[model samples]
Target chain A: MRFYAVAVYGFLYLPIAIIALFSFSAGRSASSMDGFSTGWYVRALSNPFVMEALWTSLKVAFFSAVLATVSGTMAALALTGMKGRLRAIFDVLVMIAVMIPGVVIGIAALIALATAFSAINPWLEVVLGRQLSMGLGTLIGLHGMFTMSLVVLLVRGRLETFDRAQIEASNDLGASPLGTFLQVTLPQIAPAILAGFLLAFTFSFDDFIMAFFVAGSETTLPIYIFSSIRRGVTPEINAIGTMVMVASLTLLIIAQILLRTGTLRAKG
Target chain B: MAITQARARALLLTPAGLWYAALLLFPLAVVLIFSFGERNPIGGYAPGFTLEQYANLPARFAAFRNTLTLAPLGTVAALLIAYPLAYYLAIKVSVRWKTTLLILVIVPFWTSILIRSYAWIYLLGGNGIPALLEAFGLGELRLINTPFAVLVGIVYGYLPLMVFPIYVALEKLDKSLLEAASDLGAPPWRSFLQITLPMSMPGVMTGSMLVFILLTGEFLIPAILGGGKVFFVGNALVDLFLQSRNWAFGSAVAVALIVIMLIVVALYTRAVRRFGVRRDDVGLM
Candidate 1:
């Protein structure tokens, strides 16, 4: 068992170790490890397209995270107060949203967005003097839609354990609903909110399929990585991939720490 | 006063309900509507209704065939590889080492799969693993762009997903039960088969479902590792929608995929519940 476990760890890290090792290689072919150099990293960073995609990913994740948090927090609260059949339907809907293949979602969104734009094309042309279609906004909306469930699950789990008396006390002192939520509920569940945002951001940043469909010509990081891989393998992509791996791992570590020690949970 | 209470509840639901409907339901409705329509000559859907798209399903039979077989095979492969590691961590590791090791398991999981798959591309490429094998007099072996490579990539990408759930189940198991089983004439292996494996059924089911479901939709591994020769439904759908721009046929495929996903998930839930092991908290992806 000990040997097997060590072997499993080796398997997990083997490719990662290789990629990191090769990213510093002076050679272009990833299979060959030549003299070490930082040329690939410089090339990856200097590439304007890589920078653009990175910026787009960050912007999309930030916006989607905020939207998902707000909507999900509200939904979680509403779900708690819901009764019987309505709550069951909402529950199933959320499950379906997550369970359905992302490709299905992507196609549906693509078709839907195209149809929507066609219907509004005349109006759009009248207003903006051109037809509009899917872009970063659509990507953000899709990410927010799919990731809302994670927020609901996290925030609702926290809310279930939350003390009701504190909220009642705020209400007992004649606080408005907004006031009561802000003063009593929000602060207590802030950690769950933070965790949800982080999860949403992670999903958004790492997303590829849905982004691939809706992102139009404005490439996001995953799409860019994918297209580059398709066009031809490059050592510079390995460098970029290494940097992305490091960044996401760092975010996840921060998320684990936040969720583990804070009100939200790392484990289910 | 009663109206006010109802109104407050309605207000709270408005944003989420709207978001769900516009994003999920509306798109779903559009796809369903398009599934019955015809594909236009210029690409995308036309207004005419027909069952031709459903009948045309067999056109991508190879993709569906590959998906059905590989998804389960990949799940089993992941399960076989992950079980022992999860067992070691949960049952054998010291408390101090457990945290660091588990974190290591997850850090890679959170990294972009694109990066991970890219790594595999090079490893399985000409001068990578094959070269190593050549050094050992194994002859020049072809690993890249094969089903073997796809399976390896699948197992590698999903190992952590399979591990964590099993680890959680094993971690929470009653050691006293195992000890009691062992206190009797039964050996450690027997005790494990009876107590540990049966008790960890939820994790196994959850992990298998999560991996299997995702694997069914996967295109990236096949695209990168299989070199576009090996295809799944996801790859087919990507081509139908993006390349062909065949919206009606794409919608039909999309609807079929959803139905298949729903049926499989439902069947899995029923099977799990039929066994009286309903552990829904598999830490949903």
Candidate 2:
């Protein structure tokens, strides 16, 4: 069992380790590590295309995370007051949102947006003399809505363990509902919401399929990587990959620490 | 005040409710409606109603076939490898290092699957594994751009998704049940077969469903690793919409894929219910 576990861990991490190690290669070939150098990292950073895509990805991730966190938290909070059939329907919708494949979401969103654009672009042209097209806005909207389900799940999970007595106590003391929520509920769910936001951001930053479909003329980092890699793997691509790996892993670690400490504090 | 509270609840739900209605429900409804429409001469959809796209579903049957076969295979392969690792982590690992070990399991997952699949391309390409094998007198062999390579990428990409659910299930499992079973003179293996496996079925189901559903719409793995040979429904959808601009047919494929996913979820739900697992226990997120 121990050997099997070790092997599985190796399987999971070896490719990632290889990517990280080879990213600093002085050689141009991705398959071989000629010597240690940060040239690829420098080159990747200086490349205008990579930087532009990275900036777009960051913008999309930031906006989507904020949107998802706020809206999903609100939905989760409201769902607490719901029950019976209405709650059940909402639960199904959220679950379906999460369960639907990224590809399907992409295609569905593409068609939906296309249909919407055709119907709305004419009106916009008559008024603003311009048209709405898919780009950063679409990417942010798609990622935010999709990831909102995740936020809802996380906050709802936290709410399950939440002590309702605190809210009642605040109410009994003549505290306003808003005051009680601000003082009690927000603190309790803050960790989950933050964790959800980090996850949402990570997902948006790393996403390719849905972005590929609806990004229109815009490019995301993952989409950039996909296209560049299709040309052929390079140390530069490896450098970008390593950077993404490091960035997301760091975020994940922070989120993990937050969740663990949050639970510990709650228990204490 | 009561009316205000009701209004506040409505206000809270409005954004998410509208978001879902617009992005989620409306999009899906559009796909359904468009699937029945006809493709124009120029490629995109036209307003005419027709069953032509549905009838033409067999045009991309190979893509559907490959996805159905490989997605299940990938799920089962991931499950086989993941179950033991999850078992070791939950059952064998000491508490002192459990969190670190668990986090290590997820570290790779935090990275983009696209980047991870890129790494696999080099590893399975001529100079990586094949080179090593040649040094050992195994001779030359093709690995990249094959179905085998795609399977490897799928398993590698989805391992954490598979691992976590089973780990959560095992972690939540009552160890006392195993002790009681042993106290009744059941062998260790017997106790495991009776207690551990059944209890973790929900996790197994959840992980499998997640992987399977995602794999059905998988585009990146087969695209990056399969090198255009191993087509999936997702690839077909991408080609239809992005490349060919066949919106109607793409919508049909999308509709088909959703129906298949719905069926898988329904079956999984039934199985979970049969095992008497609470719906909440099978965490999708």
Candidate 3:
């Protein structure tokens, strides 16, 4: 059992270790390990394109995470008050979104966006204006769409264990629906909200496919890394990848810590 | 307390409901509509309705075949490896080390799978692992740009996803059940097969479903590690949408993929539920 455990761990970590090691290797060839230096990191930081892509990725992730969290929290709250078939329907819909391939969603959005355009009917044009082709806005919108389902699933689990009585008490005290939600509900589910936020951010940050379709000329880090790899391996890519790995891992660890501290209580 | 709260709940739900409807449902409806429509000769969609694209689905049969074949094989390989590790983490590890070990399992998940797969490209490339193998008189061996390379990358990329769910399921399992099995004179392996494995079925089902579904649509590992030689439906979709700019055909493919996924998910859910029901019935008997 221990052997198996160690072997699995090795499988998981070895690739990452190799990536990290190669990031610092002085050699340009991905296959050759020619010794280590921090030169790649320096080059990665100094390169204007890499910096721009990094900034773009962070900006996209921030907006996507925020929007996803808000919508996901709303969905979760609605789910808690739902019962029977409605709840079942919502559950299935959320799962379907989760299970649907990113490639399918990306292409569907592109098709839908393109179709909405060029058809000049007033309603069609209005919808097209909203979709308005794939760009940074569309990329963020798609990221939020793909990630909101997971947020709903996670936050809903938190809300399931939430004490309804507290909301009732707040309501009985003459708090408005919005006020009770602001003062009572938000505090209770904040950890799930944070978890949802971080998870969505990580997902959006690492996302490539949907971003690839919608980003137009804007380069998110993953898309940049992807194109770089396609053009053949580079030490600069390793540097960028290493940075992304460190940042994402740090955020994930923090999220796990928050979750384990009982900050986000799982109601179910 | 009840009726007014229900009304408040409905009010709160309005924003999210409208958002989902407008963004998610509406786009999906558009795709469904376009899938049934004719493709304009140049590009995009034509007003006239037809299922010509669906009829042309056989054009990408190779993509579908590759996906179907690889997805299950990847799932099984991941499961075969994940189960024992999960078992060890859940049953054998001391409380002091379990948290650390579990964290280790998840640590890789923090990195982008794209970067991770890229690393595999190099290691399995000409100068990395194969070179090392050749040093020991194994001779020159090509590991990269093959189905086996893709499998290795897939298993590596998805192992944490497979492990965590199963680990959570096993961790939540009651230890006393294993003790009871042992007291009944079942050997360790027998106890595992009879008690442990049966009880962990939920996790197994969930993890396998998660990995299987994702693997079916995977593009990155195949594109990178398989050197674009291993065509998948996902790669086809990417090409149709991004490279070819064929929205109409892409929509058709997307709809087809969704239909296939829905069927698989339905069958899987039914099978799992039946297994659960039968297990419960046996317990009652």
Candidate 4:
């Protein structure tokens, strides 16, 4: 069993380790492990398109995470406190949002946004003096909603063990609702919220399918990677892939740390 | 003041509610409606109610066939590999090593599947694994752009998804029960079959469902690893919507995918309930 676990772990990291190792390779492709060089890394870093796509992904991730975290936090708070069938409805909505395959969501988003923009674009041109269909804003909006379920789930996990007496104590001490939330409610659940934010950010940043549909002409990192791969594989792409792999892993580690500590300390 | 409490709760919930309705429900409704519509002259959806889109399902029968076979096959493949790893991690690992090992399991999951698939291209491509095999006298092999390559990628990609749930289920298994079985002269293998396997069914079911559903819509793996040769419904949807611009047909495909998923999930839920093991394991799915 122990040997099996080690092998499984090896299998898990095989591709990632290969990509990272080959990223610094002097070899043209992965087959030859020819002595190492930083050429591919340098090229991937300097490539203008890579930079732009990374920037676009970072922007989308940042805004979507922010939107999902805030909205999900509110929804989580409301859900933890509320009771009734409305909660069930919202619960199903979250499940449906998550359960719907990325392809389905992609097409659905395409239809919904396309019709909305077509219907509204003419009116916008008449009123606001310009026509804008799908763009970065729509992409961000769709991504934000797409990842909101993760945010809510994380927050609600923390809320499941949430101590109610703290809130009651805050209210009993004459703290305003806002003050209670900021000082009392927020501090403990802060870890979960931050975790949610980071996760949603990673999910949005890594998204390919949904973004491919609603992206319009704005290329995010994954889409850029997809096009580049379609053209042909190169060591530079491996370099980019390695960089992204490292970045997301770091975020995930930080999130896990937050989760573990949050559960332990928030037990108070 | 009474109304303010209700109003405050509503205020908190409204954003999420409205967001789901707008982004999730509304889009799905659009897909459902568009499924019955006609593809216009230029390719996008046209305004007409018709079963013609449904009639055209056979056009992508190849894709549907590939997806149906591969989704289940891949799920089984992932489960076969994942179950043993998860069993070891849950049953055998010491606490000192468990956290590190578990974290390692999840590390790859955090990275983009695209990046992982890209790496596989090199690993499975002519200049990679197959080349090594050929040099080693395994004979010339064409692993790249094949169903086998796609399956490899699927199992690699979904390993963690299947592993964790089973780990959770196995960890939750009461160890003393196994001891109880063993002390009664039952062999370890029999105990495992009688106690551990049955106890872990929920996790297995959950993991399989997760892998199966995701695989059904999988595009990136087959696209990246299959090298445009293999086709799944996801590839079909991508072509229908992105390449062909056939909104009505694409929506019909999407609806078909959903109905298939619904049937599978519905049957899975029934199985889980029948086993009386249904729990928050379903929630994770």
Candidate 5:
């Protein structure tokens, strides 16, 4: 069993390790194992397009994470105080959103946006005084939509394990509902909310399919990577990928550490 | 206080409910409508209600066939690889190493699957693994751009997703049941087969279903590893939307894929339920 576990872990990490190693390799070919240098990373960092895409990805991820966390927390709170079939229905709906493929969601959002805009026949367009189309705004909207379900899942799971007696006691002691929620509930579930935020951010950052549809003319990092790969593989992409991997892993580790500490403190 | 709180709760729900209705439910409604509409000659959706796109579904039969075949194969492959690792982490490994091992399992997930799949592309290419094989005088092996390559990529990409669920289930399992089975004279393997396996079926089902459902719409792996020859319905949808700009046709395919997924998920839940596990046991996120 230990052998199997070790082997599986190796299978999971070996390729990524190789990619990280080769990003610094003097040679570009995967077959070659030359001396390490940070030349590729330097080149990747200096490239204007790579920098632009990175900024765009960060911007999208930040806003999308904030939006998703807010909506998801609210939805979880609403669901928690509900009962019976309505709760079940909402649960199923959220799950369905999570389960649907990114490609389908992307296409559906594009189609819906286009159809609704065109259907207004320039009347509402005149009223609004602008043409609405895909771009950064659409990308953020699509990413938020894609990520909201995941946030709900994570926060809802946390809510399920919550102790309700504390809230009852706080209310009984003459604290108002809002005050009790703010002083008690929010702090208790802060780790879960942060987990949801990190997960949603990572997801939106790495997202390709939905961004492919809604990005319009502006490109995110993943889209840029896709186009670059289509053109040809370069050592620069390996460098970019290495950076992305490091950033994502750092965020993930922080989130996990926070989760562990939160759980431990809760138990205490 | 109760009346005010109820009203406040309703008010709290309004934002998310409105968001879901506008962004999720409304878009899906539009897709359903477009799926029934005709494709305009120029490339977007046209509002003449017709089921011609559905009738022409045979155009993408190849894509559907590939998806249906590969999704299950990928799920089984992932399960076969993940189950033993999960068992080890849950039951055999000491507490000291479990967290480290589980973290290693999930490390790959932090990177984009696209980046991971790209690494597979290089490793399986002519100059990578094949060259290593050639050094041993195994003769030149063509491994890249094959269906097998695609399967390898799928298993590699999805293994963690499969492993974590099974690991959680096994970790939460009652150890006394296994001990009782052992004390009743069942060998370790038999105890695993009888006691451990049945109890973990819910996790197995959940993991497999999750993998299978995602694999059905997989495009990136096939695109990156299969070199664009082996196509799935997801790739077909991508082409229809991005390449062909056939919004109506894409909508039709999207609707079909959704329906098929619904059927598969429904069947899977039924099958898992029939295994006599509780609902919470079977569906772990």
Candidate 6:
């Protein structure tokens, strides 16, 4: 059993380890090691296309995280007071958002947006003298709405065990509702909110499946890498992959810590 | 001026409600509508409604067949491998290392699955494991671009999703029940079968459903690892929309996939409910 456990861990990490190791390979091919050098990493960083995609990814991830955090926090707070079937319907909707395959989401969103664009573009051309298309805004909207479920789940879970005494005490002390919310409720849920935001960012940044369909000539990092990979993975691709992995893993670790600390703080 | 609870709720839920209505519900409705529409001569959708797309479902029967066969195979394979690892982590590992181990299991998942799948291409490619085998005088063997390679990718990619839920379930198990069983002359394996297995069924079911559903729509793994040979509904959808520009047919495929997913989810919910476990206990993350 112990050996099996170790083997599973090895199986999990081996490919990742290979990617990281080969990122520094002096060789051109991804398949073989040709001694160690940081050339690929250097080249990958300096590459114009890689940098643009990375910047685009950073922008998309940041905006989407903010959007998801705010909307999901609000939804979580709102649903806490509700009871019965209405809440159930919303809960199922959230679950379905998470449950539906990314491909299905991508296709559905693509077709729907295309339809909407066709209907709305003629008016936009006459009125605003511009056209609507799938791009960063669409990416942000899709990622934000999809990841809102994560934020809702985390915040709602936190809300369920939240110490209501703090709010009640503040109210009894003649504090205004908004004042009480800012001073009491916000502080209590801040960690969860941060964690949710970080997770949303990580997911958006790492996402390719949904972005693939809707990116519409605007390349995010994963989309860029996917195109590069289709041309066959080189050592440079490995370097870019390594850099992305490091960035996302850091975000994920921070989010995990925040979630744990939030739980502990709630318990205390 | 204090607002009513109803007003506050409305204020809070409005953004999310509108977002879902427009993006989630509306898009899904479009998909349903398109599924019944006809493909234009140049591809994409046409105005006239027809069941021709539905009638054309047999064109991708092989994709559906491969997915149905391999998805369960991958899920069960993942479950089998994940169970022991989750057990070891929950029951055997010391508290000091458990968190580290758990986090390690999740670290790979933070990276783009595309990158991870790319790594497998190197490992399973001819110059990889096969070359090593040839060096050992075991003759040549081909691993890459096969169903086996795709299965390995699925199992490897989804292990953490399978592990964490089962780990949570096992960790939350009342050890006293196992202890009580052991004290009453039941062996460890027997106790596991009678007590732990039933207790962890929810986790097993949750993990299986998650992986199975994802596998049903999985294209990237098969595209990269299966080399486009082991077609899936997801790949078919991708080709239809992006490559062929057949939006109407793609919508039909998407609709069919959704129906299959809904059926699986409904069955899973029924099974979980029959076991008398609260849905909340099945933590996704």
lDDT of 5 by residue, A106-212 (tens): 88888887777677748766787777778888888878876887888877777777788999999899998889989999998899899889988999999988898
Model 3 per-residue lDDT tens digits across residues A1-268: 7777777777787878877888888887665568888998999999999899989999999998998888888878888868878678677778767777887777666666655554445665666544344577887888887778878987887777778898899989999988998999887778778888998999999998878877877999999899899998887788788889999988888777766654435343
- For model 4, which pairs clash? none
Docking quality of model 6: it rates as: high
Error of 4 at A56 (Å): 0.9
Residues A76-165, model 4: lDDT tens digits: 888886778988888888888888888788788888988987898988988998886776887888889978888888998898798989
Which of the predicted structures, 3 or 4, would earn the higher lDDT when compared with the native? 4
Interface RMSD of the candidates, in order: 1.3, 1.0, 1.6, 1.1, 1.4, 1.0
lDDT of 1 by residue, B1-285 (tens): 667866776787787788888888899899999989998899888987899999999988898889888889999999998888888999999998999999889777888888898788878888788988999999989998889999999889999999999999899887877777777878988988767887788788889889998998887888889888888899999999889988888888777877877788888888788544333332210
DockQ of candidate 4 (2 decimals) = 0.80
Model 1 misplaced stretches (Cα beyond 4 Å):
A127-130, A169-176, A264-268, B1-5, B277-285
- Total clashing residue pairs per candidate? 0, 0, 1, 0, 0, 0
Using DockQ as the yardstick, the better of models 3 and 5 is: 5
True contacts kept of each: 0.72, 0.84, 0.69, 0.80, 0.65, 0.81
TM-score of chain A of 5: 0.94
Sort every candidate by DockQ, greatest first. 6, 2, 4, 1, 5, 3
**Best-matching candidate per lDDT:** 2
Q: What is the TM-score of chain B alone in each candidate?
A: 0.93, 0.94, 0.92, 0.95, 0.93, 0.93
lDDT of 4 by residue, B135-159 (tens): 9999999998999999999989988
In terms of docking quality, how is candidate 2 classified?
A: high
Model 6, C-alpha of B4: deviation from truth (Å): 2.1
Write the candidate numbers in order of decreasing lDDT: 2, 6, 4, 1, 5, 3
Residue A70 in model 2: shift from native, Å?
Answer: 1.3
Question: All candidates' lDDT scores?
Answer: 0.86, 0.90, 0.82, 0.88, 0.85, 0.89
* Residues B1-285, model 2: lDDT tens digits: 878877887899899999999888999998999899988889888987899999999999999999999999999999999999999999999999898899889888888899888888878998889999999999899999999999999999998999999999899988887878888999999978878888888899999988898888799999999999988898898899889999999999888998998899889889888876543342321
DockQ of each: 0.72, 0.80, 0.66, 0.80, 0.70, 0.81
Candidate achieving higher DockQ, 1 or 6: 6
Badly placed stretches (over 4 Å) of model 6 are: B1-3, B277-285
